[model samples]
Structures are given as C-alpha cells and as structure tokens.
Target chain A: MKELQDRIRIDGQVIGTQTLKVDSFLNHQIDPAFIMRMGETLADKFTQDGVTKILTVESSGIAVAMAAGLKLGVPVVFAKKKPAVTQDSETYLADVFSFTRKEAVQISVAAKFLVKDDVILIIDDFLAHGEALNGMVSIVRQSGAKLAGAGIVIEKRFQEGGKKLRAAGIRIETLAAIEYMEPGTIRFAQN
Target chain B: MKELQDRIRIDGQVIGTQTLKVDSFLNHQIDPAFIMRMGETLADKFTQDGVTKILTVESSGIAVAMAAGLKLGVPVVFAKKKPAVTQDSETYLADVFSFTRKEAVQISVAAKFLVKDDVILIIDDFLAHGEALNGMVSIVRQSGAKLAGAGIVIEKRFQEGGKKLRAAGIRIETLAAIEYMEPGTIRFAQN
Candidate 1:
C-alpha cells in the first residue's frame, strides 16, 4: 500500500478537482508488475472470503480485475457496457450512472456465468461516486451470489460513494484514499 | 496444447459455421486454472521475442493480455474502443473493423504508455479476419513500436486473418488453431 501511495504521488496526474488520471500505469497503459503486486494485495485481503468469482466493468477495470483474478485464482467476469440495445438473452442487467460521462447506461453479465450460491468479490481501479460498484452489486444480488465485499485500488474519500457503501454495512477496503487535490498538491487520508 | 484441445472439445460450443463460442472458459467466464496454463504456454512461445510490452484490445483480450503480462513481467497496454466521442488528448488512434459486429470503430491508446522504442507483443482471444490484429498493428506502427508478433489462443484457419499476418511477415503463434468445426466436433491444426 505504501508503494501504491508513492506511485500515486509520483505518477498520478491530478486532473481538475475530482479526477486523478493514472492511465500511465493503472487503467489504459497497465504496469504489469505493479498490477500484480496490487492483485496480491487484494488476494491477501480477500483470500479468506471464499470468493469464487471476481466481477468488474469493462475497459478500465479489466486489467486490475485480471490481476486480482489471477492471484485469487478465480474466474473474472466483466460486465460489458454496450451502447446499442442488445437483445436480452438471459443476462443479469443493471443500469449504472457514469459520473464521468454524466449518462446512465446499462451493464450486463450473462446469467450463465454468475450463479447462485457463489461468493463474488468485486474489484475496480477507482471508486469515486460508487455508481459502478452499485451496478455490480445489483448484478450480484440478482444472481443470488453472496457479496464478499468491494476492493478498490484508490478511493476518493471526498466522494459520497465510499461513504454510502460503508453506511449500508457493506465491507469496503481501499488501498489508497485521496483526501483532496489542488493545483500542485495532493493529500492522502490518515490511515 | 493438448489440454487446450481437450477443452475445446468438451466446453466449446460451435454456433453456426464459423463462430466457435468458448465463452464458457476462454472469454466470458474464464477458467482460472486453464487460463494460467495458457499464459504459461504463451510465455514459453514468446520467450525469445524479448517483448517489453503486451498489447491488446479491451473486453475479451484483457484476460489473456494480463496473463501474458504477468508471466513476462511487462506492462500491458490495451487499446480502448470508445462508443462515445472521447476527450481528445494526444492519444494514438486506430480504426478497427469488427467482423462480428460488421462495423468499423475507433480505438485509442494514450501516447505516453507506448513509446517509440518499445517492443510489443500483441495478445488476443481469437484471430479470425485479422481486422483486430490489423488495427492493433496500426496502433503499434503509429506508436513507432516494433511488433514482436502475436499470441492468439484460438485462430480460425478458415479465416484470412492468420494467413494475412503471416503473409505480411509477422510472427504468429496460436495455442490452438481450429482447421474445421462441425456440430459438436472441432479439429485442431496438426502441430
């Protein structure tokens, strides 16, 4: 976690007030070594939960999901956000609001992949508004899979997403929580 | 590769004449153990390429890319297909034609992750019409990075994609190349 914090300070770009762009290593262009380390961390955190599957959203969350999936030795299922209307074919669907795009979109996982009586661990790169997490949670609930909890690489403490989840009694663990960010300065949450 | 061939026969579904849906283990719902084996096989195949990075498109390819990235200890850069107009930054862009979707879409990668001197190995789930490979090739070329060839889990030999890449003098290695598939029967290329 200290290494991740250090990486955030050195490589992370504070974009505007809310967004921290880590495309250099986390999302778009992945640091395979760093991601593997992060995956191990997540696995260590959730190893005792009996997690059978790891769920995440497509595009950005795929790499981190993959890393954790490999370490946890669990099948990783990523919900796809298709822009066009896909003919509903036995998929667990949920509508999620993306704060970045400021739009509500549907995300889905095939019913065949997620089954009842399986423990699901949800992992993602960023947890800001928690809309994506909520969507994944909805899917897990629909599938009747037990939610092991959510593991996040970085969480924006200033955002209501993390707070809301914790308030709902959902166990949430974040490696690095950003308190605030200014033009040339950034702050971390007190451990 | 025998394990992969056995998996194809047992778990893979042949839909129509061309589409061999291995979604049960390869793409949608991954078999963690089999995937790790596939990753090891890819590592063995590309050990001599001196690959510095692993490149692939989003969604399906992310799992295999992460697998290879873990083994090679190199970063994986995934090209994102943006359904909406992405915020224009200095990103490497390429137009890819999807054979399944039958449409051309724009995919982009941040310019920072891919440098000019990097040697990249492309990883993907399926190699068919080679449109995805060609699109990735365009991105690698745009980045001025050398393509160390591709590692495909399953290549449809009936499709022109594999043939085209080999004809273009790019090194391609597929764990299981399907020569033909009938109802409930799949044939692999004799290695």
Candidate 2:
C-alpha cells in the first residue's frame, strides 16, 4: 500500500481540485507488475472470506480484477457497459453515473456467472462517488451471492463514497486514499 | 496451444457459423490463472523479439495484455475505445469497425506511452477481420515504434484478417486458430 501511495504521488497528475490522472500507470497505460502487487495486497485482505469470484466493471477495473483474481485463485467477471452480440440475454443489471464521463451507463453480468453459492469480492480502479461500486453491489445482491467486500485501488477520501458505503455496512479497502487535491498537490488520508 | 484449443472446444459457444463465444474464460468472465497460461504461451512465442511493450484495446483485451505484460516484464498500454476525461489530448488514433458490435469506433492511445524506441507487441482476445488489430498497428506506426508482431488468443482463420495481416508482413501467432465453426462444432486450422 505504501508503494502504491508513493507511486501515486510520483506519477499521478492532479487536474483542477478533483481529478487525478494516473493514466501513465493505472488507468490507461498500465504497469502490470505494479498492479499485480496492488492486487496481491487487495486479495490478501479477503483471502479468508472464501471468495468464489471477483467482480468488476470495465474498462479500468479489468486489469486490477484480473490480477486480484489470479492472486485469489478465483474467476474474474467484468460487467459490461453495453451488451455485446455474444452476451447472454439473462443478466443482472445496474445503472452507474460516471462523473468523469458525465454520463449514465448500465453495467451487467451474465446470470450464469454469479449464483447464490458464490461469494463475491468487488474490485475497481477508483472509488469516488461510489456509483460503480454500488452498482456492482446491487448486482451481487440480485444474484443472492454473499458479499466478501470491495477492494479498490484508489479512493477519494474527500468524497462521500467511501463514507456512505462504510455506513451501509459494506467493507471497503483501498490501497491509496486521497484526502484532497489541488492542481499540483495531493494529500493522503492519515489512518 | 493444445490446452487452449482443448479449452476452446470445451467452453466456447459457437453462434451460427461465424461467432464463437469464449466468454466463460476469455472475455466477459475471465479465468485469470488460465489466461496467465495463455499469456505465457503468447509471450513465449515472442520471447526473442525484445518486446518493450504490450499493446491492446480496453475491456476484453486488458486481462490478456496484463497477463502477457507480466510474463514479458514490460508495461502494457491499452487503447481506449473512447477517450476518458483523464486521457491525454495528444494521441494516435485509428478507426476500427467491429464485426460483433456492428458499429465503427475510434480507438486511441496516449502519445507518450508509445515512442520510437519502443518495440510493441499487440495482444488481443480475438482477431476476425483485423479491424482492431489494424487500428493498433496504425497507432504503433504513428508513434514510430518498431512492432515485434501480434499475439492473439484466437484467430478466425476462416476470415481474411489473418491472411491479410500475414500477407502484409506482420508476424502473427495465435493460440487457437479456428478454421470454421457451426452451431455446435469448431474446427481448428492445421499448421
């Protein structure tokens, strides 16, 4: 986690007071080795939860989820923003509003992937407004699967997403928790 | 490669005559460990090529690219189907027509990720008409990077993409090359 924080400080670009661009290593252009380390840290937290599957919403979450899934030795299922031609008709759907894109999109996972006997760990690249996290949670609930928790790479602590999700009794863990940010400065939340 | 062909035959769902859905492990729902094996196989094929970076498009390709990058000990850069808010303004772009989605989409990579000195190996989940492959090849060329070649998990050999790209002097290696497919059968192309 410390390594992730250090890397974020070194490579993350702060735009305005809200956006942090980690495109160099996290979101767009990924550092696979670094991400694998982050994923191991996340998977370590939920190793004893009997997680049968790792769930995430694409396109950013896929890399982290894949790494975590490999670490946890479980299958990774990514919710699609739009159903592809090969997508199954039966699916659990959730609506997510993206603050960055300024749009609402539906994310869905095929029904066959998640079942009542499954224990799901939701993973993603960032947790800000919690729309995407909440959407995955909703889908997990719909499938009647036991929720292990959520593992996030980065969380905006200044935002209410983490607080609200914690208040709702959902266990959430983040590698880097950003307290606040300016055009050139980023502050991390102290434990 | 045999394992991949065997897995495809067991898990892939052939739709009509042209589509084979391996969503159970390759795309929608991914088996990370299995993909890591496929990645190793792909990476093995190009181990002597001095691949400096692994490139792919986002969503489906991220998992395999991450795996391949990890195996190759290189950074993986995924092209965004649509530029995100954090995306760089300066980019190398190309238009790709999706046979499955039935629409054309522009994929772009941040110019900083690919440089003239970088040797790129494009990785993807599927190659049908070479639209996506061609798009990434174009981006790599735009950046003036030397291309090692492409590593695809599956190639629809019945289609013209593989032949066309090979004819153009691009080295392509596929784990499973499907010669043809029907509602319940898939035949692999013999080397």
Worst 10 residues of 1 chain B by lDDT: B82-91
Model 2 clash pairs are none
Q: Identify the runs in model 1 with alpha carbons over 4 angstroms from their true place.
A: A83-88, B83-88
Q: What CAPRI class is candidate 2? A: high
lDDT of 1 by residue, A12-72 (tens): 8887788787777887778877887887787789989999999888877776777788788
* lDDT of each residue in B76-163, candidate 2, tens digit only: 9999998777667789999999888889999999899999999999999999999999999999999999999999999999888989
Q: Could you give candidate 2's per-residue lDDT for residues A1-191 as a string of tens digits?
A: 78988888889888888888899999888999999999989999999999999999999998989889989999999999997776677899999998889999999999999999999999999999999999999999999999999999999988789899999999998898999999778888874
Fraction of the native A-B contacts that model 2 recovers? 0.96
Cα misplacement distance, residue B163 of candidate 2 (Å): 0.7
Per-model TM-score, in order, reads: 0.94, 0.98
DockQ of each candidate's interface versus the true one?
0.62, 0.91
TM-score of chain B of each: 0.95, 0.97
CA shift of A12, model 2, Å: 0.5
DockQ of 1: 0.62
